[model samples]
Target chain A: MVKKLRNYIGGSWVDSTATNFTPVVNPATCELLAECPDSPRADVDKAVKAAQEAYEEWRRTPVLSRAQYMYRFKNLLEERFEDLVEVVVKENGKTRDEARGEVRRGIESVDYAVSVPTVMRGYKVEDISSGIDETAERQPMGVFAAITPFNFPMMVPLWFLPTAITCGNTYIVKPSPQTPLSMELVYELLDELDLPEGVVNLVLGGKEASLAVMEHPGIVGVSFVGSTPVAKIVYETCAKHGKRVQAQGGAKNYIAVMPDANMEASVANIMGSAYGCAGQRCLAGSVVVAVGDAYEPLKNELVKRASGLRVGYGLSETTQMGTVISASAKERIESMIQMGVEEGAQPLLDGRGVKVEGFENGTFVGPTILDGVTPEMKVAREEIFGPVLSIMHVPDFDTAVEVINKSRYGNAASLFTSTGKYAREFKYRVNAGNIGINVGVAAATASFPFGGQKESFFGDLHGQGPDAIEFFTDRKILIERWL
Target chain B: MPSLNTFGAILTYAIEMESRLRDYYQAAGSEERARETDKRRSNLERVRRENVTEIKLEPIEGLDEADYALNLDDASAAGQQAAESTAARFYTDTAPKINVREVQRALERCAKQHAENASK
Candidate 1:
């Protein structure tokens, strides 16, 4: 018998009112894992109410005090980083190393959030107006909600919630149903910090629970990371309800390889960005637009490197790629490969029939590559969200720019080139939110704002960096007049 | 109150629509030997269409499918076929033998759905 999962609400674990329960399956062996509470409207209401109630005191907590709590949370995360990584690997089907990377990234977010006292500092101007003193600062948005996707359960939530909480606002999180256990553990750690009751809450469900939170009047703002369509719904619905929203959506991230670029370095970067976590990351580079004659050499190198990647359970140290989130994900990746083939793209390395001998039931798709892919092919246009790479050959830099520009998702784009001119032009020409010259993964650090343009993101900005502190807290301008 | 009621109704309808579509796909996939599965799938699709239309009628517009599709016909066809086959395998056999084409089509459908939904 599997242990039943419970929701963390108002500072304690509680049984869900919903009768329907979803079994958390291990993507490794298709084993019956733990069961998570299927949250309903009633549960959402309870969590929201708790968060609302806690916000009053939480927002009033001094900045230094809030910073203290964040430091404690960061310490807790670091101390138990290995444990969290294990849970992520087991529940989310990412490699142990990749899970560790997520843990590190999540901790980094927390660390950044801990610096809220400085990041949230106000700017002051003296005598801007005659005999008037002016100042501007950020304040908490009361009770907020974060709806994070399964790809990076731990890291993505920390991207928003830590800053939200550190800025003295209560939060309710709706983690992905597919990978709820790791988040539940994080919630438990939060509870250990002895924060105010209802300061942080967790509601686990598919769509209904998310809808309830988004529709709730108590939630003043919502920060979401998921597919574009769902992000739009969250953004529009929350906006309609008069809530501030920062919803980051899907990406068809491009990595343009210049003819003069180093093939080995480009291939290495592409390997990590495209195949890491089985290419489930929102920032994962799905499309590689090769310039001029770089296509053949880059394609051969990518295929060779991708083929050598080991696919298995995340716990295995030797495993380079792990099982996908579910069997459905494996099927989806395979279909995209088929589409690539049907669309007349050449398959250099096919991962469709890959089966790990010992773990036959695991949702594992080996690394795959398609050559001579065009912008029209499904593999090139769509976000496969798996360990599959689509290579599009462009005759020149202009064609590469056109191809990257034509993509609907403008989340992140990278250019691997030795020439400064090509890098500068690509940087200026590409329509993505995050850009990289030689770097494959252009994810912004804590200092820079992270978000995309076009259909890749909804709402105004992204979570983390400067934008996160801004998102968690509202800006207020104070003016004084003397007659 | 009207807005709240409309929102509630839309939520219920969306959930119901998702469930029905899932069930229909599952049934169609499972009843591989039976010819009625196709009709069942079609009925479920009709319900999905109606539900989408009804939900969109609310003052607050829900997500549009146009925002999510790369190539609607190809993605949907591939997804539907994959769902049908997976359902068939799940119901009829204990073995986990899956057709590569069916799995691939299903994968494309899923990714397209993600892409479409994310775009919205």
Candidate 2:
């Protein structure tokens, strides 16, 4: 009951010419939802060329006119918000609540784009030195493409697309082959806006399609969100081709808790940070560092609450946790959990053998917590990206921050503490891009830049806010001294 | 009690409550129920869209979905009274417990409506 998904290029849904296609299976029921066409390099070329053709006219269009499209798109999204959220739930395996949250974030980005005319304003000075004037205007770069990850099919691409297009750059989006339908649905909405034919194009595929976007000379910039390893390759490839690139990679975020933290609130937030979205997000708190006097109580409460979470299909009303993205993802996550156990970390709750009655074949992994984890273990340092939390006990906050800072990834870290001194110190000392004080996930909203440091991010600017405006446009300065 | 350990979980329960009420009203088939069905349906969409931000991840304590369960199976006038009373009690009991100001206010308004219905 599944048909081959098509690529939306040149304002219409066109079938990919590739001979091969990738299977997209629902993680909850193991049903084939659709077959994603493994679009070849040629599709990417066509998309970029189309975008290039559109950019010439789109760039000349007034910024206010661009903002109008975003406003209408925002209204359209709100009108059909539930339908989009349902698509996210079915395709991405996020619970309805989580999918709603994702759409909220995505729409918030579109909402932000509506204010682009104000945010993208340039600077002008009447006189710099002796009757000289200076003005700097933000001009849209040509064609840009975003290669988004599967975990957030709607939100992640929306993070870049609205701003990129509103800033006057024609765009091509290559969604993860695993979950391209949500973006395809979004593209339908974009097509309804009826801008120029190629203003925003969607190309679906795997690595070859991505490589084409990177290697294509017409594409001025590239935006990527995925694994750190692949992000590095994208960065290097874009560099060799002299294109601006922003590549957000994997994370192993930590949430350090102090003894004085409100235990009830701390435990609840920790459950969300570690287990929400089944721990697939880049900002997900994968490690909990318990400081002196907080170890026993925090560990006990986290395990108790996590074990109580109801795991089922995303569509289930009361389901608190859902399956990982795919069977292979489930396998990888379980193997990582096993690896942690082999490395001498204690598994307090093993989710491996859990099964739902109707969805016996569902790739479900119940919430799992591993204790006695040290800083040296691979599970402690690596990105597990599953509903797995590793606990490490430290004597004090300094040691906790030390353990967190030693990691190669610096995406996010949070401190749950009642002490103002500890909170301030943690904020000052932590190397992560996002820091949380008495909070769980340090994720940034659309109004602010979603940041990453060290190996976690590879770019001059970030995904949202003013960083996105800068990323999509170049500043052109004019100095005049008219006699 | 069914645990609702975060604002997200609480909001999810709220959405289920409204959607169920809408369905129940549609099944009742009275003119009032039919009118109430649209109100409940609008409330469901409002709660779903207006809320559900990433900020809802903050912890919620001491709320349970079981406390708000509607006894819609009972079809008599007495059962209707009981359902209204239960809905009133849920909104009254949990309104202040919600820390988000807008959601708390919404629950209070819902409580007032249910309480008025229960009295009638």
Predicted structure with the largest lDDT when compared to the true one: 2
Listed for every candidate in order, the interface RMSD values in angstroms are 21.6, 3.0
Q: Give candidate 1 regions above 4 Å deviation.
A: A128-130, A481-483, B1-120
What does candidate 1's lDDT look like per residue over A171-254, in tens digits? Answer: 889998888988988998999999999999999887889898889988889888999888889889999999999888899999
Interface DockQ per candidate: 0.01, 0.43
Candidate 2 regions exceeding 4 Å error are B1-37, B58-80, B96-99
Candidate 1, residue A386: lDDT: 92
- Please provide, for model 2 over A1-483, each residue's C-alpha lDDT reduced to its tens digit, 9 standing for 90 to 100: 678999888788899998899998888988888999889999898888888889889998999999999998998889888899888888888787788889989999999998889999999999899999999999999999999999999999999999999999999999999999899889999989998889999999999999999999999999999999999999999989999999999999999999999997888888888988999999899999999999999999998888888888888656778889988899999999999999999999999979987999998988999999999999999999999999999999899989999999999999998999999999999999999987787779888999899999998899899999999999999999989
Candidate 1 local Cα displacement, residue B66, angstroms: 56
What lDDT does candidate 1 reach at residue A117?
Answer: 91
TM-score for each candidate, following the candidate numbering: 0.79, 0.95
Candidate 1 lDDT (Cα, 0 to 1): 0.76
User: Highest TM-score among the candidates is held by which one?
Assistant: 2
